[model samples]
Target: MRDANREWVFAQRPDGEPDMDSFELRESDVPEPEYGQLLVRVRYLSVDPYMRGRMRDAESYAEPWSVGDVMAGAVVGEVVESRSDDYDAGDVVTGNGTWGDYSVLDADSVAPVDPSIADLPAYLGVLGMPGRTAYFGLLEVGEPKPGDTVVVSGAAGAVGSVVGQIAKLNGCRVVGFAGTDEKVEWLTDDLGFDAAVNYKQVDDYGAALDDAAPGGVDVYFDNVGGPITDAVFPRLNVDARVAVCGQIAHYNDEGVPTGPRKLPQLIASRAKVKGLLVGDYVTRFEEASEQLGEWVATGELGHRETVVEGLDNAPDAFLGLFSGDNIGKQVVRVSDPADD
Candidate 1:
């Protein structure tokens, strides 16, 4: 049904970190879905640090890829045509889609989203995987309580935004760490975080954290697992919890470097540090969605997206994530699905 197509495939392997040439855009036939599948025109494509791991051949939670394949990430699109009863024409949905304009997917693979509650792009951000990541990682794993002080690194990104808000909802005093002062302002100003530290501006992270949260951290939401996390590890209160969500800072590292050991922090604090994958909480997606939607509807929750126009800018937008160029959720507007 398409007259023109431009799709990006992994062009070359990255040596240390990825660059624009790592992806190649080429023309192709617009794909159509088969039975139990829906043909969707991608509207918005998400950019996340977890995607960095996918670019590597190293073993991780998800499978790695060979060269000359479409890189995978979350995408929100409109169903132009459907071979299943689940979706109809013009229905906006979000799911695992490649970096392409138009693609076919099993209807079961994507979740139907209602635009009445929020925008379609939000399904790929605050109300989607990042939402679920924050929901389960905080409540289920970190177990924040009323009056607890919660501290989250990468506080301005997709998952961190929701994590801070949810912590506020639970009556916890929230402090956050971000790469820039602007992000720090957004966290404390718009997101209801009590205190935020611009990590780049701070000289000693441990001291700055102490100044922000004089009571010590009760829940540690670790996103950047390098120095920022190392600083927070020693500040956890007795019986405190830590949710190890992401390590964007180290994604580009050629090799793991040794640092000052903190075995004593682990024992003395008696803190629980747990690594989580969003897929593990698949059963609770509906529950999390319902609550997040309710919060959004009530205006208790908010999210931001750094949208990059055009499909061609996808690689640059993704590349900017490591450098802290995005404010909240990073997305590429591939094509206008409404025109279809």
Candidate 2:
């Protein structure tokens, strides 16, 4: 076993957008597992936008990270030392873990990973939280119906990609908004989206959306909230359902963000809008996981991952989320499982 561990810590709070100064990497002793915990060597570390919210000191759905606290996220790793009967030394697992090379996790909180299902990193993405979010958020909150025009903002992202594909499976006409032409192409060509607009290139998002979704949006799955979202509201058909999955556009704002009044439009359209958090569906996680796994195995659902090479670059990978630097899910490769 290694004598030392390296981890990232929340060193400071950002006034607006975070920079390298916000984090500090330090070395420490490898923690010993308690009676019900297992020491696992992390192989893949998941970097998600939600982690940004955790950086703030204010109250929200997730607990805020205090300065000097070790950063944590979903990780896929191999158990190296076990203190419980539920896991063995060689068993691979996934759970909430520290942003370090090794983490001490409660055995009950970590689930055994099946490599046959998909790649290991995939457990942090398509067959993981992001996948579940898309499944429940779109199906339950958005309530898509056949022939309905389903529109997704941040459509090339981990959750949005799945939402669009699931909408297609339900016989809905899917349209997506992506940052790059390449992402737009991937959505329409490979993901089977009926049409995709590159929001970055378009001078007027409303006009672009009109061209793609002329029938008016029946279901809007919003992941990036800003001008793109403002454009979507005015185009919503009566009885439209909106799933407010994320508002990444304002995550870095220092003060309250001001935008066009959308409540009036909502009243006119009689649209239902609801915010979603994946944790709300924890009771039915197995149901979603089983269905997602089946879809993946049958090639009915497709996924992609952008992996940064090392833990040293994890911060860079995370900050990239704001710049739209990744397509699909972004993860950091900490260690190779073969080395274990």
Top-lDDT structure, candidate number: 2
Looking at model 2, the pairs that clash are none
The lDDT for every candidate, in the order shown, is: 0.88, 0.94
lDDT of 1 by residue, 276-325 (tens): 89899898899999999999888899898889998889999999999999
Q: Candidate 2 — what's its lDDT?
A: 0.94
Worst 10 residues of 1 by lDDT: 255-264
- Quality of model 1 by C-alpha lDDT: 0.88
- Please identify model 1 stretches exceeding 4 Å from their true place: 337-340
Model 1, residue pairs in steric clash: none
What's model 1's TM-score? 0.97
lDDT of 2 by residue, 1-340 (tens): 4568999999999888988998999999998999999999999999999999999999999999999999999999999999999999999999999999999999998888899989998899998899999999999999999999999999999999999999999999999999998898889888899999988889999998889999999999999999999999999999999999999999999889999999999888999999999999999999999999999998999899999999899999999999999899999999995655
TM-scores, in order shown?
0.97, 0.98
Cα misplacement distance, residue 234 of candidate 2 (Å): 0.4
